[model samples]
Target chain A: MKGRKINPKRFEIGQLKIILLILPLVIFMGMPIIFIINHAFKPMEELFAFPPTFFVKNATLENFSKLIKFSDSSGIPLSRYLFNSLVVTVITVGLALLLTTMSAFALAKIKFKGRNALTHINQIAIMFVSTAVLIPRYLVICKLGLIDNLLAHILPLVAMPVALFLVKQFVEQVPDSLLEAAYMDGATDLDIYLKVIMPMIRPAVATAAILVFQQVWTNMETSSYFFSDDSMKTLTFYMNTLVNVNNTVAGQGMAAAASLIMFLPNLILFIILQNKVMNTMANSGIK
Target chain B: MAETTKMSRKDKKALKERMKHLKSGKLERRYARMGYIFMIPWFIGAAVFLAYPLGSSFWYALNNIRITPLGRIFSFVGQGNFTQILIQDPDFMIYLVDYLTSTIISTPIIVVFALIIAMMLNMKIKGKGFFRLIFFLPVIIVSGPILGMLTAEGAGSISAIDTQSLTSAISSVLPDIIAKPISDVFNNMITTLWYSGVQILIFLSGLQKIDKSMYEAAKIDGGSAWECFWKITLPNLKSMILLNTIYTIVFISNNSENPIIVLIEESMFSGTKEKGYGYASAMAWLYSVVVLILVGLFALLLATRKDQYEKQVKRAIKARKKEARNKKKIERRNRRNAKKIERQRAAGKITTHTTDRSDY
Candidate 1:
């Protein structure tokens, strides 16, 4: 794959064309994120300027300080919401990954009755629009007396079928002969799964984790539906409240700041795990 | 390598046989038991979470149910909710049409954009990782009220362009149908780009899987880049395209801005609709069917060739005919054996009474 550089026939467009194509696209894509950061720092005048400026004219810490005060007024410290969100997201991602890997290994490597049924269920679940399941899921949460608890958010989504779907596809690419060889070497199925299959599909695991984390982190619907407690509220919920409720002094800027704060974890995860994610084994077994 | 070679082919065959046999007896049950053990968590999760909810929703869609302070009330009205959604609510039908049309138009656009970007990024280049990060960052950052605030009016419209004038100009010159969708495209350009983030990643991963030699061979054969792309790249991207299409459809259909979804939401719990739960459930179910149909249509349109269809038909026919032939052969063999046994019994040549069943 790396051999083509010697010939230098990369078949790329001219430099100007490449620049033209990439530059505007990169700008358009980055503008919202850039604007979010700019909005965070912009003064009140700049933040509310007509049509919105592309950059902050007079950068200030006033909005951030105001945001700190806003959290103070709410009585539940900002750290409480932040801590709850952090704990929920971390546990959700870990549990989701562990459970998904187990089910995926069973579906992909082990043969037993009901496996076909499970596979079909996952396929159907992928097509499932979330809205259809929303009311019932909420009702189920209510019935289980799990409302306002963090588990309500974590439990419903941790066994998501998409993670299972992707992992199963990747695991199928694992050679049956390799499995047999491991068996002949006196490895139990669990040992082979953990030591062999897991390492082999790290890229897939990372991909699933990234996706699962993104879903849990950015989810705006769940906390609202399930938790009404101020104490149980997440950073996202707090931000939602800040954006909608506060049309007062330095409101927009603080919302932007809160958005940035909320976005930081995703940004960090993506930046750190970017390479592993792009090497996803989702398409490895495609015909 | 020499040690492996020293294990003769016969020994290898024997080993395989033993392994095959080893799967039975105590080991088979052990693996099956372990499989079920591993499956326990998922089974519990599915039963409690997925299956129950999905089944209950389907049930709710069929009946009029209300929530009161005391307890829930259920009054079964078979297909009444569906009928009301389909017949009485002509307004819903319009939104449904609008939703389906927009999804049909936008799904292809997003998938194609993702593919083009994927193809471009697949070329080895400097700062490729940086570019990938830039493209995907929006997907992470842009969501919830922040995303809403950005796309909302006045303070932070995503684009600074005079969209009103641009859309008006486009509408003035072109027919309304063409103008509306075109302007919609221009208006949603930024939003669409945001939506395409994960899709680009998915497509790039898929593009990475194609053998570099395929492109090299095509180039060696004097194929232009365009030709090589259409032949090699697009065909290989077929599955990923299907995946992205499904993802985009499901994603957009559930967007908060979707009128149908918004309407359903209002009816369900918030509003004073008489049969809120049932009607909303009905609307959701109908909407899901539409989304599914659109996905199916994309899958059909993007399917590679009719040749595979014909091959499937031929295989089915051959299997049916072969089964009949095998059945006929078995019947003839059974009849012949029965006749020989009867003749032997009639001739009294068998001293022992076999009872016509050859246990020996």
Candidate 2:
């Protein structure tokens, strides 16, 4: 696992040239992110300052405290929304990882009738914009009697086609000889899936997990469409309502605080699992 | 009687062979069954979630649906909603045109920008991971309402750029329809670039996979860095470009911030009797078709054509084969002519002293 020693390129003056070119873009791209962070910490007077300050002059936690107080005053506390989001995200990510990897294993390794057709179906499913299927998907949820249920959020997002595609590609790289050896030792298909395939394709699973987590965490559609009750809604939905209802000048600080709260989890998760995510994308291109 | 006996022997042999084949395939059949077992959840999920919804959505588009207190009422109105959205709804058409143009304009910019950043990050530079983390931060936090808040607070653009003069100049030169989306792209340049975070990583991974020896070989062969990039790097990364382009298109089209998607959501829950589930379904159907067409067009545009170097090599090989075949053909024709003359001379039809002009 040692790094290669004889690479032709070295860190020289040429490297500084690239740094110069990229430094400006990196700063440009990082501006909004910096702005988001600074905006959240700004006190009321600075938030509404003319010619809007790029950095916070009077940085304080007042906006966050105000946001917490406002939410506490409401009947449904912000904690309830956060709890709901966590539960939904956890269950969705777990179930989606299981279903996607298992299905990918079958499609990639096993010789079966209609396997190509199933893969084709999944590929075509990737092309479907979720908006196109909204009404009927809603109808399906209603018919299943999951309208006010938490399962409504978890079920619809479980079958992710792109995740399946990526994992299946990773699974195909599992040599046939490895599977044969496992089978020769009297292991069943499920055993191989759990012990061998699962261990090897960990990077892909992590990638899929991150994708499903982001999808479920940020998704406000289910709460908006399926659930009519406010108590059952997620943090994102609540944040959105908070920002929209109080669009007055006094509400800007609180809105900025809420945006930061929602953004922090995703940033933290990516920072932790980024290497695995990069590994997964390394094999994602169509061959 | 003899033929019947032979035919019976052949039939029995065929039956025996069939039995052997079936016996040999028993293990494969078991594996196939196991494959189906593993696939059971997906089968059920696809049928219920994907197939049924698609079928019902198409049907919903054709019907006049009413969600009432007692029960849902469905009055079948064939193409009524489609025509209404196509002809009557001004917002739908305008938003559709805007979505199409902006998507077309921004997709390449996003992809190319991603490629440039990826290439920069791929170099042997200091703090590569730090730069990557900065570049990729956008993908994590980019959601509808959050982005809406950011843009509303004027954080979507650089303060230094005078977008007013730029927009004015662009509008003066071009027509209104085309000019508007281009200016919008410039205005939200940061946000548009943010869309490329995932694309940048995708490109970076692809760049890493390109064998370093190819570049070394090119350098040894006296190829300039620019030449090496166009010849070696670009061709190898062609498929990745196509993949990233399609991903960006799908992502942008389905994003919650997309105006067309917001429009559909509004019409779906609109208080008006005319605009409800049925009308929204029709609008979604139209919008998705546009998205699919855009994806198809970009796919076609970036689809890996046969490599130019390989094509030229193939052409040269084909020409050599054709030349060899032509040489053989001429030698055979000369041999035949010589043989014919020798036979004629032996038969005394022509003598060496009196050579015929036809022999030449």
Candidate 3:
């Protein structure tokens, strides 16, 4: 795949032009994450420096050890928060991808009563900001007595409209003949959906999965709003609390470490799936 | 005997023909039922989590809402809350203007920036995937608090060169009005780049879908690269551009750190339950109106008539499918109705004259 030559006629831009144009942007974008990662290893005094030290003089595990020491006096241990984030992110993202992909199939492939109407309704939901609905959503959660419950946070995002929309756009590219062939062989909608369509739209799934996983992962505000229980707190919530607590020299170092810990999984995931994600996104078959 | 004799000959023939298992509409309905079943989970979730909450926001906005000791209470207050937020609240108005301005300002910059990067990536560049990865990496790391912090000083200038001095130097050379936004985009370039992650992906995908022959055809016809882009690439990307615009608007405006959102939250949680929730909901509604209008304007600018040919093709395809479905539906309905009459006749419920609709 790597050695295959690219067609110059594709975008008709000079190689140097692309390089010159993208260099500034890539440098601008990549620098901060590098700093954040480097800052995590700094000793306490360096963390406190203004016009902050771009690189730590000496890297140490003191921040993480300090984080552990501080958590000893807290209501829930830090590891529990990490576990909470992991459990919720995995389940919610999985459920969201399944539900959205299935829905995208039905809406994109199957013609039924009210199909257009339903798609439009969901599109309108896209424009209508979710923040407006927060109070009511909170009330809806409370009415079901799910307050202080992790389920409360997870349930709301399990049917993601944005992800569904993306998958639908991708699934529409799936040849109708494929579904018809499945139908000819006696595959039901559910069967076609699970076996045939889902496999075809893998890139959309990856894209949607990445999106939802990030949403669930970096989520700090919503969890605090819904769940007051300490044990149910997410890693983001704990990190926020860690960052805001007293702003001590040791605390800043620990906060940096926490940022790294929180940032690592996503970074690792990005490295793994980004190419597939880009390919899927680019998979729109215009030809 | 007379009741049986009074039955039309047409009905007798139809009923005689109905005794087979080929009443296909039932089977089709069964298929539809399966489709509905497939949709049920999303429908229920959307109703409960999305629609119900969306509807309730308007209700809460209109009413005087509060949490009572026993339960939540709502009294109709008409436009009282709306008026208060738009007309009375100073801070809400200020934040509203700021958020609205930011969204209006940022939407195009992000979309165009993403489009350029996407087209750039589409070129025959070495390390295409590498560049794509670099563009997309920020998406994963940019959300939640880290992004919020990075933008705040958010990812404050990590460069040793004084960002303040840099901006002032640039500002001194250029007019302040021109300098402010240019500096701002530079200051938030990382954030801007991060925001474009998905947009770039979307545009790249849209670019990929462009048929190779369109380019070949243009090339054969003596179309230059710039002409080909305007005629082929830009037109093809119109719908995707429209989508990216709305997405950027919603993403940027509704970000947790947006002062407007912060104001909405502070009012909802920190203000008294009686006054706070209602006013907060009203502000949120105002926020919704602004977002929708901005989105509407973008859609109009990018989407108008660009997809008209595509839309007609799609509509033609849909219309054909609908006609086929309707024909099958009527056939099934007629067959099923004929079967029902046969069953009723067998059960002795049809003791009077009957006629086929076709005969009538």
TM-score of every prediction relative to native = 0.79, 0.79, 0.78
lDDT of 2: 0.82
TM-score of 1: 0.79
Candidate 3 residue-wise lDDT, A1-287, digit = tens: 23123334355446887788888778777765777788789887777777666677988988888888888888777789878888899899888887888788888877678889889778778767676787778888989999988788689988788888888887887778777878899987878888777766665677777788888888765687788778888888888788887477557788888888888887777667665644432323223
The candidate that wins on lDDT is: 2
Interface C-alpha RMSD after superposing true interface residues, each candidate, one decimal: 4.6, 4.1, 4.1
Model 2: which residue pairs collide? none
CAPRI classification of candidate 2: acceptable
Model 3: docking quality category: acceptable
lDDT of 2 by residue, B179-211 (tens): 899999999988899888877866765676566
lDDT of 2 at A119: 91
DockQ score, prediction 1: 0.35
Error of 3 at B272 (Å): 4.8
Q: Candidate 1 lDDT, tens digit per residue, A212-254?
A: 9988887767788888887887888888789878867657778
Which segments of model 1 are wrong by more than 4 Å? A1-19, A175-187, A278-287, B1-35, B152-179, B211-232, B271-273, B303-360
lDDT of 1 by residue, B273-348 (tens): 4558877888888887777778778878877554556789989999999999999999999999999988998899
Q: Which of the two, 1 or 3, has more DockQ?
A: 1
